[model samples]
Target: MAITIELDDAMASQLRSEAAARQMSLEEFGRRLLAEAMHRIQVSSNWRARNQRRVELIRKSTSAELTAAEQAELDDLQAELYERMETADQDLLDRIADLENTVMP
Candidate 1:
């Protein structure tokens, strides 16, 4: 059976606008969302299991010292994550700006 998910008025308007921009029907757009949600669910499941293993490993590393190269790699990963977060923030700001001018409220 197909499921119905309710969105608040604002989110529904945003989805409709995005679908219009892509020249897609609301049903087609919703299918895309469902597909992405499935993928995300799988990823989160894997992440949680891996995170548990990581926590176990961290608990086992009481006297572990980070080598210079390891520290550099950690710094690089942090920088990349920060940059990705910044880009996401910028995209959110742009979307909010678009929403601000919508007459559908």
Candidate 2:
């Protein structure tokens, strides 16, 4: 598919410089960057969906005694959820720092 995007001169120059530094054509660099971003977005969405289901199960278990297997599954999911949340918090802080550098005086 062919699409036309209008980037301001500053952004276009920055992108061109980055592509040149990487020894990649602008199209290839843009494609790789976009593909990586999309993959991250999809992974984040899947993680949220899985975590939501786990949260629901945990909540339900609060109302009744979970079987041994269910309890084990919940324990594993909770650990993973905590780890992911920590990573996400760090990512957010990093992004905030980047934005501050870019836009702050």
Candidate 3:
């Protein structure tokens, strides 16, 4: 897919300066930044799906009582999901700060 974005002259100049500082063209910089953001989103989404499945399984086994191993697995999944969600949230905030730094005076 191809997309076009229109940036004001001032913003463009700032982006150019940042690109030069990193020794990359603006296009390459944008692509790399966007790819990282997208990967984070994908990971978060996958974790959400896995978390939901674990929740469903726990619910299904609630009436019958889960074995120790099953309970341990669910606990592990919940912990991992929490960590992943926290990381994703932090990544988003960090990315926002980075973009703000680039555009803000």
The C-alpha local distance difference test score for the whole of candidate 1 amounts to 0.76
Q: What is the TM-score of each candidate against the true structure?
A: 0.52, 0.68, 0.57
Candidate 1: lDDT of 80? 55
- The digit string of per-residue lDDT tens for model 1 on 1-105 reads 788889999999999999999999998998998899999899668756655654554454466866676556556545655775798899999899889879556
lDDT of 1 at 16: 97
lDDT of 2 by residue, 1-105 (tens): 977788999999998999999999999998998899999999889988878878878898989888898788888888988998899899999999999999994
lDDT of each: 0.76, 0.90, 0.86
**Poorest 10 consecutive residues by lDDT, candidate 2:** 49-58
Q: If candidate 1 were superposed on the true structure by all CA atoms, what would the RMSD be?
A: 5.9
Highest-lDDT candidate? 2
Per-residue lDDT value at 35 in model 3: 91
The prediction achieving the highest TM-score against the true structure is 2
- lDDT tens digits by residue: candidate 3, 1-105: 888889899988998898899999999988887899999799879977888879876896878888888788888898887887798899999999999999994
lDDT assessment of candidate 2:
0.90
Candidate 2 deviates by what RMSD? 3.6
Model 1 / residue 93 / CA error / Å: 11
